[model samples]
Target: MLYATASQTVGPYLHIGLADRYCDDLTGDAPGLRDSRIVIEGRVLDGQGAPVPDGMVEIWQANPNGRYRHPEDERTHLPLVDGFTGFGRVPTGPDGSFRFITVKPGAVPDVHGVPQAPHILVSVFMRGLLKHVATRMYFPDEAAANANDGVLRLVPPARRDTLVARRGDDGALRWDIVLQGEGETVFFDI
Candidate 1:
């Protein structure tokens, strides 16, 4: 999806659904078997800071092992995670927050085929925002490789931390999406 910041920032967002076909970011390869089951929940908001309650947030990611559903992948030797769909949707709450219950995603290698840190990639589509900004949600504090991700390397240093989730007291990762204002999700141009 594309957006023009100055004007007409509302009223149109290219229907990304048409690109329903997704392959692994690395090789444009599909999954050997279906294994990813991730849920993304967040609110859709307008420029005036109001919740767009009826908006939709679409999410897609690889299985825990980092395999996609694309047909060209050649790695079927790996075991598949069970009971996971690798995709899901959720609407925002009254205050403009949404929640999803999905399993943690596996890792996908970089352009060099070097295994990068694991993460859940999310897409936000709301009312008024012309495009569904796409960003990746990373596991908190995986220091060793967080510094190794090729994509993460592109974000300006100060903003990269917000891209990862922080661990909650319950040991689960928690991340919030702020549609507008300072600290909005760092969307990518990929």
Candidate 2:
């Protein structure tokens, strides 16, 4: 009898070896070109620190030129990744962890010429919740940019870090946000 090493079966993913094979999502490198880039992963846990197995998490970002991919956007030259959704959805695994690979979004302007701010849009849906929570994720380290950001100003200085994400490696970065718990992240009316 022969057994495979964990690395052989799971690559970098541990413990969940073999069981952690890829889903049918178009996340892997493609034949022609790969629009799939940058993975953001985190666990969604409850107040008691248990994983919420059933929920949906969505992330959206601007294009490389500080513009959105929406037709209504007036940006004349925002670069767009061919297949990247600018948005991606992920359902939690058994442990309540999910992951997504997408191209990093660019900053969008607030008043045409002025770049409004750089941010990522996050939407999460869970059972029993009356409505989905809409929120903005910002970068914590960018003090200068964040200070001038319209959205970041809404959050008090001491607690602003909760909304800002960290830059890691060459990927989209990582974060763990909460809807309603101790020290819940602020949600915007907009």
Candidate 3:
């Protein structure tokens, strides 16, 4: 008789072969963007608020003109920055911290052509989960745009704040991910 294989969690060794691909600075090669550059920093926390130091975080976003570098983003009218890739991946440090340097993305349209709030698509991969969790990191200053965002409306008002990153005194955007328990960061089904 055939038997099913047991499920395995995401990682402890994710960095082994992926180290060469790690890119924390999306702005390193890109220059002369129309929008201002921004720093996004965050930590991955567990149920009891302890850090998950071995996780990986990845982000995808549009350029300042709201156009992705990928061919699938067929809005040819929107100019693409010469060196902007619109994608980044980095591993959590010993303190469960990760940082990315990039310009703030512009609003992209949904399938219906309605504009979405300026946000970065995020994916978290860590141990204790068979699949990665997906979420969005919205800009705190884009309150008006965020309020009208179709995707943001899908999340309850009370929990919506979890998706918005807070601007710290140092001016870097900070967002924390809670795997479970009280004050958990919202994860989308996708």
- Best lDDT among the predictions, by candidate number: 3
Task: Quantify all predictions' global Cα lDDT against the true fold.
Answer: 0.63, 0.63, 0.91
Q: Measure candidate 3: CA RMSD.
A: 1.3
TM-score per model over all chains:
0.71, 0.72, 0.96
Candidate 3: regions farther than 4 A off: none
- The backbone clash count of each candidate, in order, is 7, 4, 0
List the lowest-lDDT window of 10 residues for candidate 2: 7-16
Judging by lDDT, tell me the better candidate of 2 and 3. Answer: 3
Using alpha carbons, what is the TM-score of model 2?
0.72
Tens-digit lDDT track of model 2 for 39-122: 567667676667767766667777555666678776566655554445566667788887766554566767546665577788
Q: With candidate 1 superimposed using the best TM-score fit, by how many Å does residue 1's alpha carbon deviate from the native? A: 28
Name the TM-score of candidate 3: 0.96
